[model samples]
Target: MDLYARFDLPPPPPPTVFSRDHTDGRARMPNFASVDEVSKFVDASRLWRHSRGANDFLRFGTAYLLVISLLVAAGILHKIYKRSFWVFRIVPRGHSNILIPNVHNSWALFITPYLWILAASSIAHIIGDARNEPVVNISLWISIMWSPTLFAVWYQAWGLIAARLGDGSASFEELPGHSLTKSMPSWLINAVFLLLPVVPSVAASLVGAIGNAHLEHARYGWYDWHTKYDGTPELTRDMVLDAQNIFHESIRGAYHVCISQAIWGMMCFLFGTAHSFATSSLIFSIGDHLQAKRRAVLAQKPRIIPQALPTHAPVIDRSLPQISQSDFSFKWRTADEAISKPLPSITCDSMSTDNQHSRIETRMYTFGQRMHDQHISFFPAIKSSSTIVRIEASKAERVLNFFIIQSVSIMLGTVALISDSLYMALHSYAAAEANNYESAFITGYIAVVIITLLAGTGSFISSTHTTFEASFTALLYARRFDPGSSDISSSGGERTDFLNME
Candidate 1:
């Protein structure tokens, strides 16, 4: 007590320099513990936030879906208009005798659908961006066009089923006339295919919702508009206290809206499908009408009548006196001479020519009979026999062909997905390093363009290959099933009339 009184000062206060426990009147800034932590927080608010990535993904995914859908739609339409119907016939090289128009329809098949898809997708994209709509909203609109595209896919599947049931023939008699609803397998039509077209839209919507949720959860403090001016006089404590009451009110609200987006997508998809179904049915009816008309015309052609004429006749020679150097004409034999002269017996060369003509006529009739027997008079390239064994063999061949093409598609899809991911990563890294985000995005866009071009090229090649393969397979089937038919032989060598559309 005596020593404390002598010192006359309290024990030295504890140092406030590195201690947060001090109760000092001086203001202290908030501590982040380390520079790295501050750097991480800043990055979260700017470059490394989950919301930013999610938004980018949404934009890219929507565009990609639109592009792919365009390609698929064009491909299906091309198959339906050109390959399935043979609306245009191939002409022989250097032989312009055919009266048919020479206009090429291939570009129409490619460009028309491209323009349609482009217009629809661009409109959706612009509207979504202008309105600041959610990803699911934009996707739902884009899916409207997707449903009609699937119609062609379903139509192709129907064609396949028709071919199988018809024993690899697509003739109106063998294929159903009512609609695709009748032609598709009951299980596939009622259950699988109908659901498949909706799956992509549903999956995308779900993914977008999940991504949005993740983005909201990982948001940083600095990103909050309230905390943005925390140190300034304009942000008062009382106001911040009041804002906390309503800040969390709408956090869960955005996610709940996804349900509505999903419903809208479903409705649009159904509408498009119904529209396509009706349109396709009408087209099928028209096709049936045209085929029936063609049959009637063929049946109405006049039959050629053969007359038995003497193969050889005595040569007529009448020498006339020359009236003038420039005006001299030969005289016909007199009626008496003509009546008196007996027709010479048919010579061996003339007889041989007659026999050859008879053989040709007999061969034509026999070929027609064989075509009827093969059940492919209407569909020339499709060859089917009365025996079930032959049909089964053809089915196996068709399966093999489809399997190979499907495998190629699967492989290409996988490669494209991986490539897209890798390119996106590259874009992100390059953009961050250069700190020129706009340029980076533009480069990414260029990459997408490249990818789309490559995809289009691949699709074109695959389609060409498939068309050729189908035609060739049909031809081979025809030859194997009807080897004796001279019609197929002559046309097969001279032209591509035997299309294996099956």
Candidate 2:
């Protein structure tokens, strides 16, 4: 039968009570008036009084197991710490002085206090359970679990800010789309970063609740006898056989519920991981595209000239000129005499030589003119708006904006995750108590530890990647916009003469 069907409500019943009279002097007591009477009698009887007894031993036992698991996980985190420590030391030596204040760093400031809270909560829960007392309750756990989701929302806002800063185009405001800057109002953006982690954390909490409910139903059936006793009791063959069918049905229902809860929790984990990876990948891809475009522009060579100029004069004007001294006394030779007396027979070969020399002189003169034109220096117009000082100032403003937003997000996320983990751990134990199933509590504890460790590791990796990418992008932009200072020459006269001759 379906689990929902099993939950069908039963018809109302009349009340009655059980009474034993010694007047009959019989060894056996008389039965109750009705089913209601029997149930009421059972409810009122001291036989089920042990149900109120606190299972302190079970609580402490599970708490200790969780602590040990955390210790083992801490060792894994330690290895990461050692590696990161070295990187932190080395990066500063080569890194630029401009440090983007990332919120991830703030985790260091509050991590100790956060860990203490978690440890204290766990211990309190264990001690309370050992003494049959309630430590942290469900309301507190729900609040804790939801914290991380809030942090994720906060981080998303930071990402938006970073996106706006890294945007290359100056007309971001005029672009034909909703601008990241304009569309996301300051309050709304901050709210989103504040609320992001809440979704996954809430999902996890819901799943955990379902798991607890399932365990509660299972323990009620399996340990129904023990609920009223300190230990397992032996039943007669007939009684045990009679209870087997109901027990099996309850167990099956509980198993189904627990499985569903597990699936739900797994979904939350997968979703969170996917979001983190997608965000990081997008940032990386955009940065790479920009860098590639810059490189392509820089690699192109300016157009080049192919050949050198030759040194020679043309002969077109070289022949002697006939002068008449203002058309008076000077005699000029006749055309026939000049032609016949062409000192050496002006042969085709000679003419060819004269043509070649003329071509050479023309080429040299043209080259010199080209060189002289190139030598004229025009000062590039100084537009204050396009100056390096203005550009750098703008970049600095953007960087500061991005850093402030991103850092807030990181800190919030870290706190939320840690708090949620602690809450879940305690909640799991509570669920186990409600069900009187030791295994359920143990399994839940293990799951919480595993999830916490995974989240911490994920955060650490994501922060590192974001940091590196941001640094690389900053370096790229710096090189592009600021291309360093150049030296100027002082010898002006010599330079001018060289230019005129060229």
lDDT of 1 by residue, 186-251 (tens): 445435543554665455446445534433432333245335543444433333322221222111
Per-prediction RMSD in angstroms?
20.8, 25.5
Best-matching candidate per TM-score: 2
**Model 1: residue 49 alpha-carbon error in angstroms:** 10
TM-scores for candidates 1 onward, in order: 0.31, 0.34
**Prediction 2 TM-score vs. true:** 0.34
Kindly list the per-residue Cα lDDT of model 2 for residues 277-299, writing each as its tens digit. Answer: 43444344434433443333233
Q: List the residue pairs that clash in candidate 1.
A: 474-500
Residue 482 Cα positional deviation in candidate 2, in Å, after optimal superposition = 16
